[model samples]
Structures are given as C-alpha cells and as structure tokens.
Target: MHKLGYFYLPSGKQIALEISESTNKYRYSTNKDKVKFPNIESIIKLFDQTPPFDNSRNLSHFEQIREFTIAKGGRKGFTVYIYECEFNKMKEIKGSPFSKYGDGHESLGLKRGSRVIGRYIDTGKKYKDKYVFSSISLINDN
Candidate 1:
C-alpha cells in the first residue's frame, strides 16, 4: 500500500459522496437553484436503524465529513466539497492491523491514530473503527 491522500473526518464510517471528476463542471452550473447538500438520502441509507438503533449516531457521523478541498468554487450558491482518503495505500509492517487480534502492526506513520471511534474534527460524530471508505477521491491536478 502507499499513502496517496488523507481525510479530515474521523477514522471510520466510510462516506460515499458522489461528485463529478471534472473540476470545471463542479463550479459551473446552468441551474441557478443549487442544493448545498446532495445525496443526503443516499447517505442516510448507509446507517443501521435496528437493535441498539444507531440511527442518530450514524447520521451524525455522516455529517462530520468536513470539506477537505474545494473542488470548485465561484459565485455559485454552494461550494462543491471534495474529500480525499488514501490511508489504505500506506505500507504496513508484518503483523495484524489490529493490536487485539495478533502481534499488531499499526502506527506505521500512515494513520495518525489507531482505528477507534475518534470524534471527527469539531464534529460530534462518534465514527466507527476504520470503516473501509469506498469511492474515495484521487488528487486532481487539473
């Protein structure tokens, strides 16, 4: 693995926000009415609502994802947020990722902290322990 990016949010509870790969398109919109938060329903669906019901906890978790990088900004109503997370690519030592599991091979300088429900930066979201964040963004030079 290789360290390619980082996320400002807490370490767990992967976020699946969908944004266009085009930077120009991100800021430029023909429609005057723009929604600040899109795909909110989709984000809500990722939570668990049964037994020990963590709906509120999960919802709060999803909201903590801060704006890592402004993908596009202008005179638009709302700015397009593009967060990046590439901690998985980092090289690990010869041991289990979790200390409780085996010899444990963490703190290789890739992840800032252990996989725990750390409160996200400023957000009160008690994120889970290292949820596999999917559809993470790639650094866009263009």
Candidate 2:
C-alpha cells in the first residue's frame, strides 16, 4: 500500500485522499476564458513525485481532487469546500514530501491544506492509516 496524500479540514477532521495516474490535458483555455487551475497534470505529478507520501495510499483521492479542482477552476470564484486536511503536521517517523512542502523554509508556505469530502476508514498503520475524501463541483456552485 502507498500513501501519496492526505487532507484535513478546519473542523479538525482528517482524511486520506486517493491518487491515480491520469492521461489527460489538465489545463485548457477556450475562446472565452483561461482555466484558472491549469496544469492539473503537472499538479498531480507534483503531488505524486513530491516525496515521503509518494508511497502512501492517499494518491488516488488526491489525484481525483486535483482533476476536479482543475476542471472547476480551483481556488477561483466561489468553491464549495469540504473537509480540510493538513499533511505536513501529521508526521510519523521518516520525513515526507508533504511535511517538507511547508516547513517554513520552503517556497511553498508555512501551512498547506486542501478541501475535500468522502468516506475515510482508519487502517491503524504506523503511517498507512487511510481516509477517503471525494467530491467534485464547479467553483460557482454550479
């Protein structure tokens, strides 16, 4: 089992998202507007190739979330955000890519979080404990 990514909401809820390989153009621009969250593929790769969490089981959900976000212009307009998960904070033994993303020393940020919602089951593993957060919609509540 692999642990790719995870999420925690502001309500103190924790979940482990899934990750999967996608073969589609992430970002796209039409004659009308440019997709806000472009390069979703890159983002997935970023999430996948990042580190410690790479082998985690959260990759599938993470990749799915990324796809949904990109399709709906993530972080743009109004988004129906669900649970929020903090990866870097839930550290175990070895260092993880997510933990290093926002260590207050990297260019990412001091704190990194993602919004999602789904059924999560606890695995009780040292670091394999998993959660499932899944849901997709437009940013404008459409």
Candidate 3:
C-alpha cells in the first residue's frame, strides 16, 4: 500500500492513510490502476494554506455514504458524515454530481461509515451550507 496521507486526531494520535491497486477491483476494467495517488505533501500544503470555515475544525477522519439518484447522468449523490473529534457531535455535508457511476466506493471496499481521509479545496460551491470537496480518495489501509 502506498501512503497517501495522514490524519491527526485531536488527542494527537496520527493515523497513516494508504491505498493500493490490489484493493481496487475495477482497476483492471478502468484506468484506476494507472492513476497516481495524489501527492500527500501537496495536499497538506494546500490544506494549511486554505482557511477553515467559520464553524469548522480541521477534519481528522470522516465517513462517506453514496446515495443513489435518478438525476441527469444517473450519478449518485455523496454525503460526508463527520463526527467532531473534539466535540463528539454529528454533522453532515451533502452534495450532488458525484462522478462515480460505474464502480464506486463499494468497489473499493468502502462502506457507509468507512474510515477515510479526503482532500478538498475552496471551490466556492456550497452544499447544504457546507463546503464541498473537489475530490476524495478512499483509504485502503490493509
């Protein structure tokens, strides 16, 4: 598994996030096997330079759920489930136009509440009063 990034919990424990082509079942069918993992250094640099939302704290780890939709292109909707590591409160961030229509999170062995690390940018797109990510990657920590 290639180390993609790290998630730092509020308690100061760091979790190493990783990914592997073997875990991706659709790699042979798609170009996923050839796709390079996002640069961890670049992601961290971007995150550090970006300002946090008013009521948002740096995300440690998150849960993801893909809701099926009949909208144009038949793309599924994505909802990020966040539990504030410090506050222990549940919050949600929802959005549409998810690009994965064929093999999705499930194909990567990801479930509704699977622990994941993600990367997002300030695209000025708001989803249900929260910022939406430009892209996210599933962590295959096996």
Candidate 4:
C-alpha cells in the first residue's frame, strides 16, 4: 500500500491519495509500468502552480488534470489512487469526456460527504449533476 497523503474535507471526513505500484518489482517494465506519483516536497511546490483544471466539479480527475510539473520526489512507476470512506461501497461508473486527464478513469455519482457540485460539461450543457474535488492539496503534513 503506497499511501501518500490524506485530505480533510469541510465535513471532517478524510480522502487519501495513494500510488498503485507494481508489487512484483522484479517484473517491472519501463513501457508497461512507469508513473510519476506526486510526493510531499513536490506537492508543496504545486501549491502555487495553477491547477490542471480550475473547475474540478465539472470534470473528473482524468478530465480535470493532464500533467503535473514536479520539481522532485515521485515514484518512477505508479498509479494515483484517491481513497476515502465516502467511496466505500461505491459502485463504479463512467467518467466525463476527454479533456485533460483523458478517458479510462471512472466517475461516480455521490451525494454524501462534502461535495463540490457541477453542471453538465458537454456542449449541450445541462443542470447540476457532477461532483468534483475542492483542491489538489492532498499532502498530509501532520
């Protein structure tokens, strides 16, 4: 379990960010397994950088974020995993359209915990129905 950091929501609940690393280190392949997972020191530097997407509610992580400019400290190969009790028992669903983080990532309909709601992100534009992250500052200093 490559747990990196946790975030405290406005409601007091917590969200955690972890890296999905290849368990079989010996089997590691540069082509198949190569990720730049964020770290504490690097995370702190990103505090000033503009977010991948200012409006996270309308976009999924894959959609809202594309790339992060890191100064140092990151896993060579890993996956970013955001975990939370709120996501417990949560059913997997489809994410938003292509934008930044790209497709393949799942999006869920959530009504619990502290949330930032957004409207339809498509060209048609609909009413509020999406949930998004409030910030990218997931570093748990304490």
Q: What is the C-alpha local distance difference test score of each model?
A: 0.28, 0.30, 0.31, 0.28
Candidate 4 stretches with Cα past 4 Å from truth are 1-18, 22-39, 56-142
| Candidate 3 structure, TM-score to reference | 0.19
Candidate 1 residues lying further than 4 Å off, grouped into runs, are: 1-12, 15-38, 54-89, 99-142
lDDT of 2 by residue, 16-108 (tens): 222221112323343354323324564454445433233344457667556544564554422121222346333221222122212311222
Compose the digit string of candidate 3's lDDT tens values, residues 1-142.
1111223221111112222323353356555455444457755654564222221334332311111123222345343322111243223322222344222234334563342323322122333333333333322337
Model 1 TM-score is 0.23
C-alpha positional error of residue 117 in candidate 4 after TM-score superposition, expressed in Å? 32
Cα-based RMSD of candidate 4: 18.4
Listed in order, each prediction's TM-score against the native is: 0.23, 0.16, 0.19, 0.18
Model 2 spans > 4 angstroms off:
1-59, 77-142
Give each prediction's root-mean-square deviation over alpha carbons.
Answer: 16.8, 19.0, 18.0, 18.4
Candidate 4 lDDT over residue span 30-87, tens digit each: 6565554546664455444443344535544443323222311112321222222233
Best by TM-score: 1
Order the candidates by TM-score, highest first — what do you get?
1, 3, 4, 2
| Per-residue lDDT value at 107 in model 2 | 24
Alpha-carbon error at 120 in model 2, in Å? 17
Tens digits of per-residue lDDT, candidate 1, 89-130, equal: 422223313323111212223342343313232232222323
Candidate 1, residue 70: lDDT: 33
Best by lDDT: 3
- After TM-score superposition, the amount by which residue 55's alpha carbon in candidate 3 deviates from its true location, in angstroms, is 1.3
User: Which whole-number lDDT from 0 to 100 does residue 23 have in model 3?
Assistant: 37
